[model samples]
Target: MTLPFFVYGTLRPGEPNHDAFLRGRTRTERPARLTDAVLYDGPGYPYAVPEPGGVVHGDLITALPDAYAELLHALDALEEYVPGDPRSLYERIAREVIREPDETPVRAWVYLAAPSIATALRTGGTRIQTGDWHSRNR
Candidate 1:
């Protein structure tokens, strides 16, 4: 079965990693938002953490089964997510994303910042209040 992934940072279309990882791999992509999530600057990238009144803007990408496997591998490596690894930078988890325009809700995989990392960023990193990495970075 195909799976959907919510991408908020480098993996979004026209971003640095999109061509390398998602281009020609995803079956469909549309603007989406993850509610109850705040985005914070993390050096060259951005990290997301759950927050009561936050909303993170991103894209929902659907991948075919074969492409999903390969995409997951590449994404995991890039996000430094290792299942059961204590030192992993990010944790891949399932979450609901609200599609734009119509605001339809859909479940998708999202890479969230590790708890400790999120705490660190919350304490010191610049919060992207707008939740848009491209706009915030630019």
Candidate 2:
């Protein structure tokens, strides 16, 4: 299934990687939020770690049909997500994200911290308390 992508960190609009990767590849982008996830500060990005009651603010991006496969591949490479690789930093998963204003639910691909990374983040990583990477204090 070709679902939209829920981007919470550098991949979101106006962020560093947006133009570099998603600028011409997306057909639509809008405000959205992922439930059960929180953001942790990475060196130059943010990691979304699943947690009960957590809410992550981001964008729901729909890729143009022709760009889907390429976009997916690029994102996987950029995120260092090797399927079934224990050392991968992120894991891409499909989840429901709530669109803003209407509060409608839409299934989208979300990059979450991998198991080990999540474990470390849960124990000692600094969280981006606001759940919005752009709002994090520098």
Candidate 3:
């Protein structure tokens, strides 16, 4: 199956590392909206989760080379996310994302950060935005 990746952070093809992921490999990139979630500024990035009446707004881009699923999992987990490590902060989950007006729901993966560590969240003075990272130092 072609892995569909839901990009709500730096992977959205404009911020950092955009050239590495989106350059010359994107099949169909479109603005996507996922319901039942919200974006919160985590330690190094943003995270999303299902919240009543909440929605996660981002882009749904088809990544090529096929192995993007594994690659993305590694990249997202490269830092704070660890294999079988409860200490890890981020997690990858396959979720349903609405891509278009008439297109059927598609399966895509998104990295969700643990919200238990709200202390690490930048809740004041630093607002979070979709697909854009304004962090000075992660």
Best by lDDT: 2
lDDT for model 3: 0.63
Ordered from best to worst TM-score, the candidate numbers read 2, 1, 3
Per-residue accuracy of model 1 over 41-60 as CA lDDT, tens digit each: 88789999988889999999
Candidate 2 lDDT over residue span 1-138, tens digit each: 799999998988888899999999999999999999999999899999999999999999999999999999999999999999998999999999999979999999999999999999999999999999989997
lDDT of 2: 0.95
Clashes of each: 0, 0, 1
TM-scores, each model vs. reference? 0.95, 0.98, 0.70
Local distance difference test scores for all models: 0.91, 0.95, 0.63
Error of 3 at 43 (Å): 4.4
Every model: Cα RMSD to truth: 1.3, 0.6, 4.4
Best by TM-score: 2
